[model samples]
Target: MPASASASSTTPAAGSTIHLPKTSESEQLLKIRHSMSHVMAMAVQKLFPRAQVTIGPWTETGFYYDFDSPEPFTEADLKAIRKEMIRIINKKLPLERIEVSRAEAEARIRAQNEPYKLEILAGIQEPITLYTLGQEWWDLCAGPHVAHTGELNPQAFELESVAGAYWRGDEHNAQLQRIYGTAWETAEQLAEHKHRREEAKRRDHRRLGTDLDLFSIEDEAGAGLVFWHPRGARMRLLIEDFWRQAHFAAGYELLYTPHVADLALWRTSGHLDFYSESMFGPMAVDERLYQLRPMNCPFHVLTYASRLRSYRELPIRWAELGTVYRYERPGVMHGLMRVRGFTQDDAHVFCLPEQITAEILRILDLTEEILSAFDFRSYEINLSTRPGKSIGEDAVWELATAGLVEALSRKGWAYTIDEGGGAFYGPKIDLKIEDAIGRMWQCSTIQLDFNLPERFQLEYVAADGSRQRPIMIHRAIFGSLERFFGIMTENYAGDFPFWLAPEQVRLLPVTDEVLPFAEQVLSQLSGAGIRASVDHSGDRLGKLIRNGEQMKIPVLAVIGAREAETAAVSLRSRRDGDLGSLPVAALLKAAERANLERGATLELASPGKEHS
Candidate 1:
């Protein structure tokens, strides 16, 4: 049994002691957030007066105001508008919320030529509200604002950037300009936010991918197709190796499936009609249409149906690191976080109705085990029940839901219940792991899928020898390998743990005299399965150390004339700083031990210690 499956009292309960930053915490933050949006709207209006304001809401970190602008916002315009916003903040006008009737609100909005506000008013319930800023400026808002505009610290809020968003998060609607801004209660909080932003920028996967020669998204091949370079391939191989080991230990059978399948396969999976937009176009293969796979579930389901299963094989766990392709909008194509083509650490379990709880429990155990190996321990679990429009019968849905609840209870893990939040197919448990920087990323999901088995007519021989539909559970620990890599990069801030570090140790020779000794040391470390490299650049020792530190190499072995002669190396660690000198044999042993243990930091033997 995995450590997570073990009963523990430290586990959190749902909605207990979780710190969620809301508008109620700090009045200054709320005011700053509200006023900052108004400033952004004012800036947008000045830049493009025809742009109509729709709505702006305060998020956890910042606020975003949406507008129906004639021109799409550009990077340069963001800077100009930011300057304009600063001027507005300097004015320090008051913000007052005013209530009005439908007719009165309509008349005021009509006079201002704000048609979007009229539309907003129409959607709002009775007792409509509006916020007026010093009489001249007003927006249709139900606001909990600061007493005065002066309460908003101008320096504490910054207009981050602008993007094109749908009018009301609907793709069919017209696109609008979304100005994103971050606000804080005090200057210190603002500074911390800026520091975090800078840290995130520094650890951006795109930058690291280029600098570390990990991967590349080639423009020639079109967007979303990631080309993993040698270094990145090595890391991915290591990750996959560990993942396979863990999965096999957890009693999961690995499967390899094709990248493309016949369109009829998707039609049977019910994805052709509902999920076609996200899928790639079909290609003709000898008068038959074949489509690239956007998901591995259909393929896995087909495999299960390939043979008539037996109740004895109930809770058959199968896993695959299958690569998938999807059609994402051009502008939404972020680095690794959002990609069109990526691999998923997907798994599917086929089990009897009575075996649902045990299978789900096993999945939860595996999810935590796999994630925790990557230094992701804290998780936020959400249990989404059936939606209004769904395929499965009420009894089956109830059975699946109850099984999930029972499994969660047995595991002693707390999860939030998202009522009516499940997919049309079935209920699901989504796990969002908290990263090192206190940011959460949804990486694991366990969904009880009732639609796929029914659509495929999947059946198994029960104890009575009757053919019955087997319940399918779809789960993915690393939701997308690419996205998980991006999150991990940001979480570690590019300073990967010793085991995961691409270049674990860089042997820096003080001079040409020690080059041979450094190479020998490097070779020895490599032979011990350590990722060690010799700096052949022949740069000064200080420069070499600086370069190694800048690249975030976990360990640096400096070979000077005395140390080389004495068969010892001066050690420096990124995490522990300088640690005098140690014999080569001791250093190699420590490196090998860290590699085997998957330790975060390498623990070198004491100085002057020699292994004989």
Candidate 2:
């Protein structure tokens, strides 16, 4: 039996629930996903005849299909499968949908000797549908596929990779070979997708982290625990400093919370029942259970309830750079992007219902200001409404959703709506910033939660001396500091701006005679608060330049006999080509100004005239 079957057969406890996105509502994404799955299934069957199809579905990125094959797929196999898929597209086969009774579907699946299909048929409801890819192939599916295979451009599709996936995503289910592919509407769209993939690979945080010697995840320390090297730590400190300054400017008071708390606090927040799976198991602390926190909201709430106050203390915006831990399954960890431990730049606001919209708007404005400083200006916003299994009352849900809508409108920003997609606790606004290559990454979220206050019986003294519950707004600008660091590293392609670069200037001496002058210039640069280093290896000028360039040093200053006598230095920059000689004072001033202004490159134009 597949791992998925083993996991699914033993159902959860009675009344247990899981959140999943339904395909019925997102018709466009669903059709693209369903059709892509069929294409993958057909490709796999064509490449490996012994392989029997199981199931495939579309995801946010693209579509993936699973097969129960005796032989594990290799990289070469994926290429051949992609070629076969293109051939199928050239045939322009019609994807005709046929509805059949359960009995008929079972008969056909059994006739084909596909046990997986038979199992799928048993689970499907009435009005069973099978989509036929021309005459040779068909799969059990309820699809809104394209009219014909010709509608899919052979040039617009690509087969990505093969991974080990359980038959139904459960680790215990039968392990199957999953083939992933992406398709778009036009050839240009396909090209753009490929470009984006290449860009993402180029900007992969793992590669940058190693090349730049920024951070690492050690197997000895256990997976998903990040170890920040000296350079990475310095950058993180700079970021933290900036974050603190911004929060103070935005009128937010800071807080510090413990990493472990009593298990009862989690129960009070209702995380014990609904979110225990993702949480670390409790530890025995003097006959009581204590667990490491996976979120900072509960701790912040406890601080709020530590002492009661009047209505004048309505919008208490408190922020923290709290680190939390959660248990993530082994194969799911990816560098700093998804980690088991991370520091969240979390903030919470307690305010009246009437202040919800304005609070959300302030958060939006702050998010934009902070992210834009890192050169991420373009944004893709999403407002998720109430889910079916939400906890808040209908009127409260409506009010919260309206608040988010009003805030978004007031900010004059366009956003997509994910209907019934909010967390069980509240509605939310998720913001994904577009990187240099147009890839979107979710990094910020502002959620209006009504469940927590009610669960904890949180109250503030009203103007009339009545106790009233204050609404809670949870927000995080950089969802995780480590993840944001990785993204920023990739965004600049490891060529950090002058203000953020690990070493802003590297002085290279052409020969032994120039070493003293190089040292003098380095001293001047360092005195001006510039990160400067001297290449004391005494290597050749060419080799020194090559080393500096390879390390992605922003500015390289060269000293020779002529420069030594003239008190000038030859300059070269990564963003700009070679700049001729300049006086030491001029170089220092430019470096200082660039660092202060956070300029991408130093402003060292060509020499105006030769020194007299």
Candidate 3:
């Protein structure tokens, strides 16, 4: 089993009688959230009449409202607001929508002395609309609200938090207070939401990274730049080693590309013209421009265009863990999850059109195998077909789409067809892996492009003595390695699987008398290719064991006088359980077996496959 995944210890209880429906999947939930925001605004204004409600919108999971208020809100204010909201809910006020002209809406705002509303009325489209909650309040909106406030459950909603926000997200504009809240159809679902939120906080990768001494985002080096510590680097090396081995086994040749490339190369590839917004500003060098690459695809295209190729070498699979940098706005920079500089496990397949189906099938197989290795067995797959406007010929588009569908059907994996969701250049397939917390993160993508080949005029000599453009398929399993590392960190809650643990084993000597034996045992374990270290800090055995547990080491070896005399060591397994003192040879054999098999736990008493 690929590391059985669940939010068991860190999320909502499995038996909780609640179903949190996605906002897109539930119209009622959307309405509830939209109405909840209005209720919160009403509550705030009732308490602070000077507070001006700006915008209140429904989000995927909740709702938020920005208010230009005279005083910042406190936690106590949130509590008071909640009480007032529920009181209004108990009144069962009817919600009514009214359509008016821009002149009338502006007149109403002026009467209410709301300058923000007047400004909003000026910018909105004609056939202006407003929603009224009973006879009390009204605001500009395009609403699909419930008939009455009674439809909302007071117990099912809660004000989450508040923070400062600039009006329209502009720094030059007046800063406003933004209040965030969540609403559901039932209180049970609210409880589940709270549980998940708490769990997410506990498993936050930023916190875990620092606590485990894994990685850091140094203030001096700037935000969004990761500085991997020794322990974190070890795990990254292991991941990369496994990735290379898997790619090689799947017939992918690794490539190394430069971090900066000639700006003309990007222009030739159409990125300079189309993707300049995400790119860093060009630097001038020797009166010419130097561009920091935000993507590796153009470089791969250059390599294919480097030399003439024959038909026999049609399918060339090149993979690279290439690092690229892009400009992320100040507030958007996040720890690993969203970064300015990161490595992408990117690969491109240059194959003949006739070989598209086979190559796609192979890629599907490879994707599943690679993802499953990291314990991601469940995937949400989407096949995006050609859009209204695209680059390739109609016949070629049909052929490429058919190839994708055929490969998916052959692979026997169900997928959702996102009609017209593909890029203008071609069709593609996207895969999102569900983590331990059941949150789906977009990771793998396979796009079949006919434009890059055409733009670069890539060609290969066919048997008929004519040159034909080869199909360009861009794919990435780990879309961004840094993001994936963060996801994996949270997925495992920093308790990495045994095979991937940075510190596999720690040897604890009960006293100074057993130090020599512990060192010998550590050497034996290290010699067997196991990551083992001994505690030499002169701490007591209890402290050593506590430290090892805190570090989440997979195994701990307790070497006492008795064990040292018997040439054995007592083991406590984090994944498995306490194993009685085993002979040095037995311990070594089990450690080697676990390391080789990539098993979840030690092979303790028996030699068969083991599970934690």
Best by TM-score: 3
Give the lowest summed-lDDT range of ten residues in model 1.
1-10
lDDT of 2 by residue, 289-311 (tens): 99999999999999999999678
* Model 2 lDDT-worst window of ten: 1-10
Which window of ten consecutive residues has the lowest lDDT sum in model 3? 2-11
TM-score of each: 0.88, 0.89, 0.94
**Residue 220 lDDT in candidate 2:** 100
Greater-TM-score candidate between 2 and 3: 3
Give the winner by lDDT: 3
Global fold similarity of model 2 (TM-score): 0.89
Better of 1 and 3 by lDDT: 3
| TM-score preference between candidates 1 and 2, better one | 2
* Per-residue accuracy of model 1 over 1-612 as CA lDDT, tens digit each: 222322222222233343324454556567668777876787788878788898998876789999887788888888888888777666777788888999999999999898778788889997888877765678888777776667777777777888778876777888887888888766666666666567668778889888777889999999988998887887888889999999999999999999999999899888888899899999999999999999999888888888999899888889999999999978678999999999999999998888888899888888878888888887778899999899888998999999999999998887779999998889999888876655667788889888888888999998898999988999999998899988887778778899998889999888898888888888898888898899999788789988998788899988889888898888888998777788888888888888888999877655544322
List all candidate RMSDs to the true structure: 4.7, 8.3, 3.2
Candidate 1 accuracy as TM-score: 0.88
